[model samples]
Structure formats: structure tokens, C-alpha cells
Target: MDESSVRKMSPRRAAELLSKTPGEELSLQAWEGLREVCVSGMQDERLSADERIGWAAAGALVVDRMRDHSECADRRVAMASEARLRAYVITRFGREDDSSLRDLSLLIRRVVDAVGAESWVVADSADGWQRMTRHEMLELRRIKNLVTPFKSILPLLSPTDPLRDKIKEWVDIIPLLP
Candidate 1:
């Protein structure tokens, strides 16, 4: 889809466009469009959390598909995409029906894998982890202590859940980050 076309896209349309469009074919404008759509979708209370996550996952896949491609070489943008994906997984996870739990698990895996050596800035609050903007979270870290959001998600997963192991592995790796 073109930039203007994507800008006008609804969550469902954006998801469908992202799913079918190859990463290499996506212009930077398209990337921005996906980001815009994902952000707006998150704020749209009319949509269920599961639906928001579905749209977020679709946007995240662009980065995953272009991981080694030059189009995704912009680290700042990639990190933002990763943060958006992580925010959805951390905040909306387990809030939906059990049928979608598996989907969330897969999205979590993808988000974690996409994170690799990147440092994620997130804030925890009574309103939940998704309430803060990335800039706000970054500012708070400059002025106060913060915790890795992944560690808090462990208690939400069952011990027998396969996703628990992946999350545990991710949590174990966090402290090792500089």
C-alpha cells in the first residue's frame, strides 16, 4: 500500500496490508504508516485487546521480515517497533479468552527475538505498562530507577506454559544488559 493509502487504513485494513506486503517492498512511508496505525489502534478502546494485539503483531512482522535487510537498518525505528510490540504483549496479554493465548505466546516469542541486544525503556504504573510514551519512559529512567517489564510478566504465566520458559530465558538475560 502507498503511504497515503496506509495512513487512511483502519486497524483491520492495516493488519491485512501488513500481512500481505513483503518487507522489502515497503517504503519508509509504509513503516511510518504501520507505526501510526498500531499506535492509534492501541488507543482505540472500541477494539478488544486481542484485536489490538493482532494489529500490533502485524506491524511488528515488518521489522522481523526486514531484520537483516537494509530497509530495517534504522536502529531507532526498529527499537520503536520492538517497543510497540512489547508494550502490547506486556499490557494486554492474558486479558483475552484462552483461545487467543497461544497467539499471544507466538507474538511474545517474536517480540523477544526481535529485541536481541536492544534496550527497552518501559514504565510500570497502576494504569499498566502501556500508559507511558517511549519518550516519557526514557525521561523517567534519566531521573529515577526503573525495572525491566519482562520480569513482571513471569507471574502471569503458568509454570507448565511453554511460553514461561521463553520469558524466563528473556528475564535471565535482562540483568546481563548494560
Candidate 2:
């Protein structure tokens, strides 16, 4: 479909398109609508688990497209998409099948890219907080909030798994933040 048509599409229709369409095929406006659908879908308690997974998958696609078109995509949209996708995966970690595990790994990598070495660098030291702007502190807090849920999911992963280690690292550092 054309950009104009996608812009005019309803949320339900946009979600349908999201499930079936590639992110590169849709305009950013369409992605906005898709993002709306995903955020709501993930939050809606009445939706079946499978349905939420579908929304999470679509959100992942949006993040992937944003990564590919980093220059063209809005940073806000990419960051929000990554945040939502990561939350969904981490919340549902133990329940996911093998394929979702693969998706989770990719999502983790994207998050690492988004947050960069900030996770390692902060350590929530007094000096780190002194050096950062208010905006930077809030962004780290946002990331901390996102990963805090991993504390519950951590036990589900094997001790030897690198993802488990990453989650442990995040859960460990976040509490040190003010």
C-alpha cells in the first residue's frame, strides 16, 4: 500500500498490516499507528498471550526497521519501540518457546546498542551522576525501569547463559541509581 493509504489506515487495520507487512514497506506514519496498536495490545490484560506476542513481534519489526533506517527514523520512535519490545520479552521470558528466545537475544543486542556502554560506565557512582545532565539521568532511569523486571525472570534462565548474566548485571546496577 502507498504511504497516504497507510496514514489513513485505522489502528486495527494498521495492526493487521504490521503482522503481515515488513517494516521497510510501511511509512513512518504507518509505523506510528502500528506502535500505538502494539503499546495497547501489550498492555491490554484481556488479550490472549499469543496475541500479545504478535504485538511484541510487530514492535520488534518496527525497531529493526528503525535500526536499518537510523538516519530516517525518529529516535523517539526507535527508543520507545525498543523499550516496549524489551519489556514484553522480559516479562514473558520463561514462557516463550525457542523462536522467542532468538528474538529476545536480538532485542537485547538492540537495547545494548541503544544504551551503548552507558550501562557499564554509570555504575551509578556519585561521580557518574555528577557528570550527567538531568536528561541523561532520566534516560538511565528509564532503562533501569525497563530492566528491573528482569529480576523476576532471571531465575528462569540457566546460570551459564550469557543473557542471564546480562540480566543479573542490569538488576544489580539499577538499584545503585538514585
Candidate 3:
């Protein structure tokens, strides 16, 4: 049969046929379930930022996740295949051409360079680390020592420039695809 006809088959009927037939498309049917779960999770609006990170951290390619995770809601992994993941990085993110692994590596380098070597980090207990804007960090630092400090404590610097090596320790963003 053709793609559409097979897609329309009930899961039970498809499985029995696969057992009787040679090279039956059980894989495609399985993937359909996975894809549905992934699409549903992607559509969930109630996920928190950390929860979103958890989703990103699943590390499955959209195609794989769409295929496999749609099968089960609880077990979805982020982009599971490198080839598909690389394709997504190029297509969805800024890299249009030269989406090769090496090209992606280069883009990461450029981004790191643009951010500069020195900076202030603001950490939220639940929200993870954020590097404050230069102006905000400065005003916090300058006024922190003067006057009866009230709410500026959160804003002011503790005089730290979390080392470049430490910054490098950030969870590998490239791995998000596969």
C-alpha cells in the first residue's frame, strides 16, 4: 500500500500485518506515536523556563523526536540523530548555509567572542544564571556601597567575573540538536 493508506491503518491492524509481512513498516507507525507526543509537548504553554530547558536538554532531532516521542509523552528525547539535528540547526537557527558540524563550531566561537571575556553574572535560584546587561551591572556596583542599601543587593555585584574557563563550562548548546 501507499503512505496515506498505511498512515490510516489502526495500530493493532498494522502490527499484525507487520508480523505476517516482510519488511512491513512497523517503524513508521511507531514513529507516528512519537511525533504526536513531541508535537504536543512543544505546544504545551504551561512549561516553566527550567522545564523548557529540560525539553531542550532532551537532545533529540525534531524529526526523530517527532517520530518517536509522539509515541510516548513521558519518554521523549531531544534530537536523537546527528544528521537530522545538524539539518535543523542550519534550517531553523541562523545558519542557512554551511550547517556542517565544523560550521556550527565556528558560529559558537563567534558568539563567545562577541560576548567578551569580562562580565557580571546574575543568578536566580530557580531560573539559572544570567549575565546582566553592562549598564545594570554597573549601576548596581556603583551604588551598592553608598547609602542605606535596600533592594540594590540583588542588583549589585559581589565583585566577580566568573572566569572564562567557567563560562566555557556552560552546558554544550550544540548538543541540543542531537
Candidate 4:
């Protein structure tokens, strides 16, 4: 959606748009609707974008995890899920501004949707990743940066191409590997 459309949205409306069609373009209209409501409840101006995106990302992550665990099917669940998704984005990126948060959330959601798989299915960090502190994210980023390129590992992992098949697969939590 364009800037004008974005300017007119409510958060609830934005959430519905995402749920109805998960991979829509970067609809600035939708982000504004949600951010308008969410940003006001926050504190630091510097963190506002981070908070918004963090809420959305964390909420989305939690919601995706709850798909089979929770039975709620109402709009309420959607609202809560959006909140969680925003939280995750904040936690990951350390920002909490309206525009930054919503932009990151939409971008992440779109990327996940485009791949036609849950985000976890694509790049789930190890079990400890969810609990990572700000220091940890920075450390991990640095560690990743310092690593030298490898011509190959013993055996390069065959990346799972999600689009080649239509069957939805579930992660077997017990196995520690999906």
C-alpha cells in the first residue's frame, strides 16, 4: 500500500491484512496503522522503532510456535500474535521506533512468507538463541563476521528448498533436528 493508504490504517486492520495474505508487499499504510497505536505506549525515542518491530517479531514467533498448541481462533489471538512478533523484532535488532519496528516486521514477514515456510524452518538459531541478550546478538554478529570462508565443510548441508513440495512439514521438537 502507498503512503496515503498507510496513513489511514488501524493496527487491527494491518494485522488482518497480514493474516489474510501473508506475503503482501511493503504496505506502508498497514504499518502506520499499527505503529500509530503501538508507538504511543513506548518510552525511548531511539528504541521506539526497535520496540515496535521487536513486538511484532516476537509475537509472530510465539504465534507460529503456538499454531498446534493453542486452540484460540479469534481476532484476539491475532492481536496478541502481532504483539509478540513486534517484541521479537525489538529483541533481535535492539531498536523500538515505530517506523523501524513496523518496517522490520513487514520485511521479516514478507521474507518468511516468500520462502513459504516458517522463519524457524529457515534459520532457527540453536536452542539458546531465543534467550540471547543484547550482548549476545552483538557477539554473534561479530563472531560470524570474523569467521573465514570455507571452500566446503566435510559435507555441505543441502539447503531445504521449501517450494519444491506442497506438503507442510512439522518440526519434531524431540529430535533436536528437524
Scored by TM-score, the top model is 2
- The local distance difference test score of each candidate is 0.54, 0.60, 0.32, 0.36
Candidate 4 per-residue lDDT, tens place, 105-171, comes to: 3433433343344424433543565477876554333322211111111022134733212112211
Task: Tell me each candidate's RMSD, in Å, in order.
Answer: 9.1, 5.2, 18.3, 17.4
Off by over 4 Å in 4: 24-139, 142-178
lDDT tens digits by residue: candidate 3, 68-119 = 4334332212222322233233333323225333244443343333333222
Question: lDDT tens digits, residues 1-178, model 1?
Answer: 6646655666567667777777677666566666666666665678887666765665565555545346664454465455545545656654443434235454454454444332333212212324667764444332221224456567777899876786676565444333
Question: How close to the true structure is residue 64 of candidate 3, measured as C-alpha lDDT?
Answer: 36
Q: Which window of 10 residues has the lowest lDDT sum in candidate 3?
A: 145-154
User: Model 2's lDDT to the true fold?
Assistant: 0.60
Pairwise TM-score winner, candidates 2 and 4: 2
Q: For candidate 3, what is the lDDT?
A: 0.32
Query: Candidate 2, which segments miss by more than 4 Å at Cα?
Result: 1-16, 19-33, 62-77, 93-102, 124-131, 135-139, 142-146, 158-162
By lDDT, who's the top model here? 2
> Model 4, residue 126: what's the lDDT?
31
In candidate 1, residue 147 scores what lDDT?
A: 23
Could you give candidate 2's per-residue lDDT for residues 1-178 as a string of tens digits?
5435544544346456655666567666666665565656656677776666655665566555655553553354466456556655566633433546235565556556666565667574424664778877676665665555566666777889777888677767877675
Task: Count clashing residue pairs per candidate.
Answer: 0, 0, 18, 31
**TM per candidate:** 0.52, 0.59, 0.22, 0.22
